[model samples]
Target: MTTATVPAPSTRADAPSASSAYRLSFGHLLRSEWIKLTTLRSTWWSIGLVALVSIGLSLLMATSLASFAGDVPPMPVVEANRQAVQVVVFSTVLTQLLAMILGTITVTGEYSTGMIRSTLTAAPGRVAALFAKAIVLAVTMFVSSVVVFTAAALVSGPILPTGPLDLGYPDSSVLPVLGAALYLALIAVMGVGVGFIIRNGPGALAAGIGLVFVAPILVMFFPRVESFQWIHDAAGYLPSNAGQSLFMGSPMTGITLEPAPALVTVLAWTAVVIAGGIAVLKTRDA
Candidate 1:
């Protein structure tokens, strides 16, 4: 009786792994998000755009610098070179747009494709999913920004030598250059939050562009009126403008918020938008 044959270990098809049958791990969620981000065509476009923008803007500014060289007196070659190169480094508006696109796609694309449903099914923890997305978006944007900025510097370096713009100087404007990249990444995260909250491409795109361009123009235009002048001053403190100060070594004298305060303001905006996204994600059926 004791010798009765023990049934061979039955291998059941579609059997769940012990861990996956129970719960999703944060690490697994992170890997999934990374895969989703890298696999998308939009991600490649966003990254390519960043590099192109950085280089293109630098070249344009370099041309402007060449035109202005006639008006200014000549100085020591290295210092002059540093100043010229700074122009290229400072011209990174395109990089900002790239970050925004990348960020928006982090959530909005999934919603559009219905992958979000699968994502939720895999990891029922809404916060976990959001956290994974934010992390992936931030890291990708940060790396892309750095690469693009470095490429811009290299491309612009040779053109500036005769015009007093030296390339690759260690001491000058490193902080601002690095800050620009970080700021771009932060902006991308802000975009992600906005995209998630809106959950539609056209609406998110419109609102994003409006905030970046239209609002600032309106604020500037109304600065003459007393009630709206406050709007103008406040506009400089908005994420797009204020965060950009990180790229400028000196503060705009009329701007009310200092560098620290401005960055904090941007951070606060990100927190609000992300919180809203989290709320929607938690309550929605997906």
Candidate 2:
């Protein structure tokens, strides 16, 4: 059978193996998630709304508060800084809602459109994929929030009663503004976990809304009954309530934790929700 030997099919030394060629790295996964997040129309709309609402609220609050500048004595440096910081971040309430909806859609939209199957097939590691999506969402939300907060600060700076309301003089607003951005980022990440748990956009959104807004309001009334005072106290540990403590100048209607405790509480809630999501992802079909 030496008649015309095929020369062993001439494999090239540099040729990539099938596994290596198809392997998806974490960087690739991140890039893919970034693309998915940026290409969606809803993402743009949410971002636009964030900017619009933040700046609009900043103007409204600044002007309304400035009207009382003459009636009230000049605020102390610390108090004025706090008020300015509060005005700059006043829009966080609505922006957090937008962030939650956007984060939920980031995951649920994939499920609804049947893209998650393809994503899983490519990434293979379900947990890594979920984490990649969350990281991307968190980064996007943080950056967007920073920009919006900065814009709000600048827009409101001149309108605020200038004597004590200095955005840069005491540097008091910096940490709070940064904290607000971080808070929004964490909220978005929590929303990602909710998306994974619910896997339905509307349901996930409703759950997020309840957690962020309705739950706090409902819990506020619990203290009035005296027996449920513990519940009202416990409500301060809720994710949104705890997160708000990071930036808000004053406490909510219920018991409130200190800033450090609030940060820890928010982080704990996010970690628990994300762990639950990972557990569901591993045990369920894509």
Best candidate per TM-score, number? 2
Question: 61-105 in candidate 1: lDDT tens per residue?
Answer: 777666766676767655664565466556555466667767886
Q: CA lDDT, every prediction?
A: 0.71, 0.86
RMSD of each: 4.7, 2.8
The TM-score, computed over Cα atoms with residue i paired to residue i, of candidate 2 is 0.91
* Local error of candidate 2 at residue 138 (angstroms): 0.6
lDDT of 2 at 158: 87
TM-scores for every candidate against the unseen true structure: 0.82, 0.91
lDDT tens per residue, model 2, 121-225: 997779999999999999999998999988888889888884335555545667878888999998899999999999999999999888887788787655467
Clashing pairs in 2: none
- By summed lDDT, the worst window of 10 consecutive residues in model 1 runs over 245-254
